[model samples]
Target: MRVLLLDNRDSFTRNLEHLLVAAAGADVTISAHPQAADVAAQRWDLVVISPGPGRPCDHPGYGPWIDGGTPLLGVCLGMQILNEHFGGTTEPLPGCVHGRAEPVEFLGRTLRVARYHSLHAATVGSGLEVLARTRSGIVMALRHTERPLLGFQFHPESFLTEDGGSLVHSALCLLGLR
Candidate 1:
């Protein structure tokens, strides 16, 4: 299977590549271009759009990939992009959530996981499904109703969460990535 890891940061890009490759024997490729159009042009079975610290909707070029037919797996900032670009809203979320291992709530229960992000605003678009939620009422996971797009607010590469690796592995299974 083939996957594309798109990100401006080289370190995050490489780490994701390694994770997917190790998880499913996927042929992972990394792209450091900040231009969303360039990343959209590539053909990929799965696109792991890395979370950028900035607002992703600020770029008009990003629309194609998210709305286009690319099966995407969003992480962190990428999750925010999924919300913002698809008719959802993103404002400053209350409190800071930064740690490798933290107890977060989802569906009335706390799940120990790693959280690393500044923004947490969420509301799935018109037809999006929120697959998971955090104790703070933050949407932690989402999926497009008619496509293979998926989003997760946490970083699986961080050593904090107990099943960070498993979370990523589950993403691959959802997309039939292997």
Candidate 2:
């Protein structure tokens, strides 16, 4: 499958691109906010939103690209995008929610990964489901109600996260990539 990787000022876009390429055997195209239009001009089967130091609301035009029915993978700030897409607010997780954990207590038990963010959005819209979260109630994982949209609040590309590689692979699996 072909996927478009959104560049959010984070190198993880390239990192995930490689990881996703090796893991899912898919062609990934990387693009930044300025080049978003060009990326949209192309035909992509899915979109992967990588973590950025910025907020989704900051990029008003980007909402439509993400809200579209195409499958999506939201990571870090990308996760917040999913929440915002579903009408949620993103504030700090009360503290530095970026670190390593054995397994965060969500619906089940998701391995702790690097979460580098201070701003979190609180959802006010609908069409989103919480797939995972920390004990602090910061929604970490979410999905779109209508299409294939998955959001994760952690960086699955950091070497500290051994399972991150597999986590992204699982996202592709959900999209039937494997």
Candidate 3:
């Protein structure tokens, strides 16, 4: 599958790329500076938004892909971007999890995932469904109601996440590429 990896200059970007290629059998393209229009001009089966350091609101270039009908998977800051684009809100967490494994309820099943973000989704807007959350009630994952878009608050590409491959595979399945 042809996958576009919109990198936000996160340190784990290379690892994420390797995982996508090795595990998902995807032809991955890395873009350091992604613009919505430029991205829309190309053909991509899936778009994976990599985790970054700043607020997703700060970079508005990704707004074009939110409703473009292609499957999208957002990680960490990418999740916040998806949330904000869909009218949701984000806030600073009371406690930050740096390379810590926490139990998260995902689609009714609990799994340990690596957490690294300082901000979490505070409120999800209309047409979006919460798929996972931490024990303390922080939103850990979400999916679009009417679109094939998913977001994860945790870093699934990191080695810290034990089921990271499975999570990524699930997203590939969502795109019907598996």
Candidate 4:
């Protein structure tokens, strides 16, 4: 599958690229400073928004992708960007969570996944559906109601997380590429 991987210039982008290519045989293109117009000009089977170090609202390039029909996956700060662009709100965590496992309820199962984010989505817009949340009720995952967009606050590409491949595979499954 042809995939557009938006690199937010984070430490995890390369790892994500490697994992997607190996796990799903995706033809991935990495773009660090992605402009919305430049992104809209490309054709991709799937688009991945990688983790970054700051608030999603700080970036002006993410708003346009919300209306595009292409399947999109947002990881860490990318998830936050999706949330914020859809009229949701994000708040700083009481403490930074890195290299830790947290219980996230997904698809009727509680899975312990690696956590590496300090911001949590407090509320989502009407167009989005919450797919998972932490034990403390922090939004951990979300999907657009009528679109092929998905978001995960956790870093599924991190080797620290057990069964991280499952997350990657699930994304491909959502895109019907698995």
Candidate 5:
């Protein structure tokens, strides 16, 4: 599979790239967060929005990609971006979470995922379904009801996440890439 991994100036992007390859056998291309127009000009089987600092509003220009019919996987801030693009709201968590591991029920299993975020989706967007959440009710995973779009609030590439590769494989399966 050909994947375009959009870098949001985050540190974990390289790890994500590696996981995409090892888990999904994807030919991944890393690009510093490109404009929607730039992304629209390319041919990609899948597009990955990497986790990054700041709120979704801080990093704009992803609407076209989200609505253009191409499959997309968003991580952390990227997931917030997806929510915001689809008319959801993002707000600060009561207490910011960073570099912590938490258990979430996903795909019929409890997965310990690494979370690093200060903000979260206050309301999910139209046509999107909540797939998983933390014990405290923080949204952990989501997918569009009709579109091939998925988002993860936690970092699957983080070493802290046990069976991280399986999460990547699960994402591909959800996106219909497997």
Candidate 6:
């Protein structure tokens, strides 16, 4: 599969890139947070938004890509960006979680996923369905009801997560790429 991996100045982008190749067998191209026009000019089978530090509002120029009808996978802050694009809100997580593993029910199974964030989705946007969440009700996974968009609040490429490759594979299946 042809994939466009958008880097948001995040540290885990390289790990994500490897996972996309090893797990999804994707031909990946890395873009360092390119402008909307640059992204719109390319032809991609999928666009993977990398995790970044800061609130969703901190990263603009993604609205056009999110609304362009292409399949997208957003991680961490990227997920927040997706939520904000659809009118959802983000707030600081009470205790803030970073460099930790949390258990959540995903894809009909219990999985421990790595989390590194201080903010989470406060209210999911319209037409987006919450697929999974932490015990504390933090949105862990979401999918647009009528669009080819998916978001993961945790880092699927982190070593702390079990079966990270499987998670990536499942995401590909969910997005109809597998």
Q: How far is candidate 3 from the true structure (C-alpha RMSD, Å)?
A: 1.6
- Winner on TM-score between 1 and 6 is 6
TM-score for each of the candidates: 0.84, 0.85, 0.93, 0.91, 0.96, 0.97
Query: How many residue pairs clash in each candidate at the backbone level?
Result: 3, 14, 0, 0, 0, 0
lDDT of each: 0.70, 0.72, 0.83, 0.82, 0.91, 0.91
lDDT score at residue 150, model 5, on the 0-100 scale: 97
Of the pair 1 and 4, which is ahead by TM-score? 4
> Over the stretch 22-61, how does candidate 1's per-residue lDDT look in tens digits?
6668887777663556556667788777866666665344
lDDT by residue for model 5 over 64-152, one digit each (tens)? 78987889999999899999888999999988999999889999999899999999999999989999999989999999988899999
Instruction: Please give, for residues 42-115, the per-residue lDDT of candidate 3 as tens digits.
Output: 99999988898978777678877777788999889888999998889988887777888877777556778888
lDDT of 6 by residue, 121-151 (tens): 9999998999999998889999998888999
CA lDDT of 133 in candidate 5? 93
Query: What does candidate 4's lDDT look like per residue over 96-121, in tens digits?
Result: 78889876767666667889988788
Per-candidate RMSD, Å: 2.8, 2.3, 1.6, 1.8, 1.2, 1.1
Per-residue error for 2 in candidate 2, Å, reads: 1.2
List residue ranges in candidate 4 displaced over 4 A: 36-40, 176-178
Candidate 6 segments exceeding 4 Å error: 36-39
- lDDT preference between candidates 2 and 3, better one: 3
lDDT of 2 by residue, 108-175 (tens): 54576666677765563488777776666666677766678778776777776757667876777665
Model 1 lDDT, residue 5, Cα: 77
lDDT of 3 at 112: 82
Misplaced by over 4 Å in model 5 are 36-39
